[model samples]
Target: MKISDIASISDAQKFILDLYPNDNRDFSYVFGYATRHLGYLCKSLCKNSPSVEEFIRSISWLLALANKLEVDVEVSLIKRHPDICPYCVVAPCKCRWTGKKPAIGIKAYKIPEELFYRAEQIKREKKADFQSHCERLAIIYPGNAYKWDAIGPWQLTSKMQEELAEVHEAATRYLSGRKSIDAVAEEFADLFAWLLSAWGLSFPEGNVDDSFIEYYLAGCPVCGNNENCECELFADLSTQLVDSDKIKELEKLFLALSSEVGFDGDEVSEVLQSLEAASKSQSEPVARAAVDQAKAKTEELEKLVERGAKNAKNATTIAQAIYKAIENFPFVG
Candidate 1:
């Protein structure tokens, strides 16, 4: 899919699946890739590079992990943030000023009302998407008010690193029965937002969505596989392929699937694209077309439908295997 078509967080997840499906990778493997790219991002920032490419790479891996885990990151973001500061539960967070102070350090601030009424109202009325969440965060924490100019790139990245550490800590606590899974999820959401903020700081004029799609235009930059990356060892990839014909073909298929099946056409197209990217012999489009043929009351439609069902079942089984493999995997960043 092209950059312009991505409108929600699920779209981003599907993009990752297209590039790196749950073929042979486990949850821990994907998690390692996420942290590995995050390390690269920190190095990039430390060296004062103008590129935010590593940041997007890290986000792509994180999305993959979330997909495997069946975590709806958009829903998690909406529940935790809801267009406001999660801790303060208000736009332009007042936790520093309006909330009570129980201590004298960074974790001192505490929300007066744990049940945020306004947050609930906003969640009910607002439709959460990745772009809108980023926009809402910009408003809730305006750069001008937050001294975005004063905070250098290194500082922003430092905050990202700090959030990563907190994610580790939260996971540790959860393992020890001191914290909940939601706490770990919250840390992840915070880290993602911070990554977006750092990207904005690095390239004020660049669009994250467009840049992301452009980076993965030909799938894994290193291995050049759209799905099931073949890179066994870490490698740097500078090549980016642009195939307008492929894009046009995928777009046409998406439109066709939208009319054929009652599923989200973009998602189904992405699934097919993943198979095509890996050069799988099984033709998903053919199977789906047979689905249409089955609608015509053909005699052999039952066999076609069974094949499609098996493919669908295999996909789910692979996803479940990945999930179980990494369900207890710890954050290693």
Candidate 2:
């Protein structure tokens, strides 16, 4: 935090090296992990910024944070930079820029959403060795956020709202007759992921890179890669997600963990935070409180919790998650 501390930081790797500077391997591992976390935090904060200038400032601070830690994020990118964003690229960039709007130079590099979804599924179902290879190279490059966790529903909400709602509609249709809560949930979450993108918040951790490459190149010069890159996004990502109320709700999640008997983990914390942030922007204080109550009851006996069960029914965040759970099996005491 101090200016001196800020200046002393080096490449993300070096800053990490300082943590355990003597133990070479451990130093590298911890630094990479820490930088990864920092990246996610930076990406998160960037969404809170209102203007592009402010966004740039947000990023600069992240770079400085990496510097104080001593990371050469630049060289790291040069060595391992991804040719194409493996997550949301419609066309593998030919690395050309004559201003804006790239004309798909090569058809081979392009993929439609249908095929893209199929490829994504195949990667998920990859053979052990193949999967390992992908995972192994994951943290080390142009960012593997897309490969497995590629299709972030919340992150890609806009594109999904534009395209995937049909899937959710179909799911809703299925639920009308069969009443499978889980099915409804799957579709809702899938559609939600895409819808949330319109808000700039994402379901999964949206990451940032602290590599020196960020300091110099900013993004992959070849492709439109930046902290704001849509490829890094889960959908046709926008950058305007913010809600003090949701943030307030997220703090309540710690209480959710303590209040709930058996459902708490960093994963749950992160998921709860994302869901709250991605909800429509309006401060419904009473509704918020009721939603928290439902979350607390979730692990207990919830019985046929239907629409308007209480003020909670109106809290979209709680209602969606709870209804999905209760749709088929409402927690009953």
Candidate 3:
């Protein structure tokens, strides 16, 4: 089924469960993997890289955790954000200038046919960046005074981190008999809310359900085989070593050329990360394809550099070409 057909958070949770029906992982293991992917999202955000894939992967794990713990994610979300700003009680949310802190309780509302649609509505109405969405949501839901104190990317990320830890702790407590499974589910709900907030803040344009469906409709992304995923066991350390060394050499050359063209270190670093991510496949054909793509990118870079590289934008374009070449080279590492 399409992800848009997922009528509520509960439905999304079930979709994730169906995706990995035989998954015997415990809560800690699931949470750890989710956290790792979330770290990837943070790294991408810090580097100004597009993080749509990272965000979707992280949410999938969290949804799995929610399903495992039987979290009423739908109610949790609707209660906190009932189609309007819970704090200002407005659709568009004008809390920035008004500085209003209305003591609003969670109001009940009929859940939408598609929960993600609510996020899309907010994105269109605000017409602001992701951080603005986080600010509005943070102010409305839970009504934390500290959240409004410093509304920025860092603050939102910090809140997400805090919620992540709480989810972990709650899970630990449940495992140790210190808390009920319901308590863990409650924490999961909080984490899911923060995750949605992060999604809104990071990706303000596209529908997440659409992206999720498109990405996963074709079985596993890594191994491209749903029946038995051997991606982790299929590693070739020797190939990896050779590729790593080659990448380091290419990185040095790219950096030197970028510096010669007056490009800053950050732009070069971002491109290098993208290239590294792209060239991680162990298959010989994919590796060869990556090498060919890298050579082409190097040629492009040479041309761009020779033809009056005036700004970092020119360097960025070259870097992007290298990244695309790497990404299109297919293989599972």
Query: 12 in model 1: Cα distance from truth in Å?
Result: 0.6
Candidate 1 lDDT over residue span 94-193, tens digit each: 6667563322223423442332454576568864555566666677666432555665566667787788778767766766799887777778788878
User: Which of the two candidates, 1 or 3, achieves a greater lDDT against the reference?
Assistant: 1
Q: Candidate 1's C-alpha lDDT?
A: 0.58
Give me the displacement of residue 16 in model 3, in angstroms: 1.2
Error of 3 at 191 (Å): 2.0
Model 1 misses residue 67 by how many Å?
Answer: 3.1
Candidate 2 on 1-333: residue-level lDDT in tens?
211232211233333233223322332343343334333333443343222232223334333333433334332222122222223332343223423233344343453443455445534554222112223233322222452255432333234433334433444465367545334434433332222222233222322222222332444222344332223212221122334444455445434432333345564555455445434443345335434544554433222233223333333344344545323211111
Ranked by lDDT, the better of candidates 2 and 3 is: 3
Q: Please, what are the lDDT tens digits per residue for candidate 3 over residues 119-198? A: 56654554332234344555555333344334545555666677888888887787788998766765665666576676
lDDT for position 332 in model 3: 23
Best of the two (1, 2) by TM-score: 1
How many collisions per candidate?
0, 34, 0
Q: How many clashing pairs in candidate 1?
A: 0
Stretches of candidate 2 exceeding 4 Å from the true structure: 1-5, 8-14, 22-333
- Per TM-score, the best of the predicted structures is 1
| TM-score of structure candidate 3 | 0.56
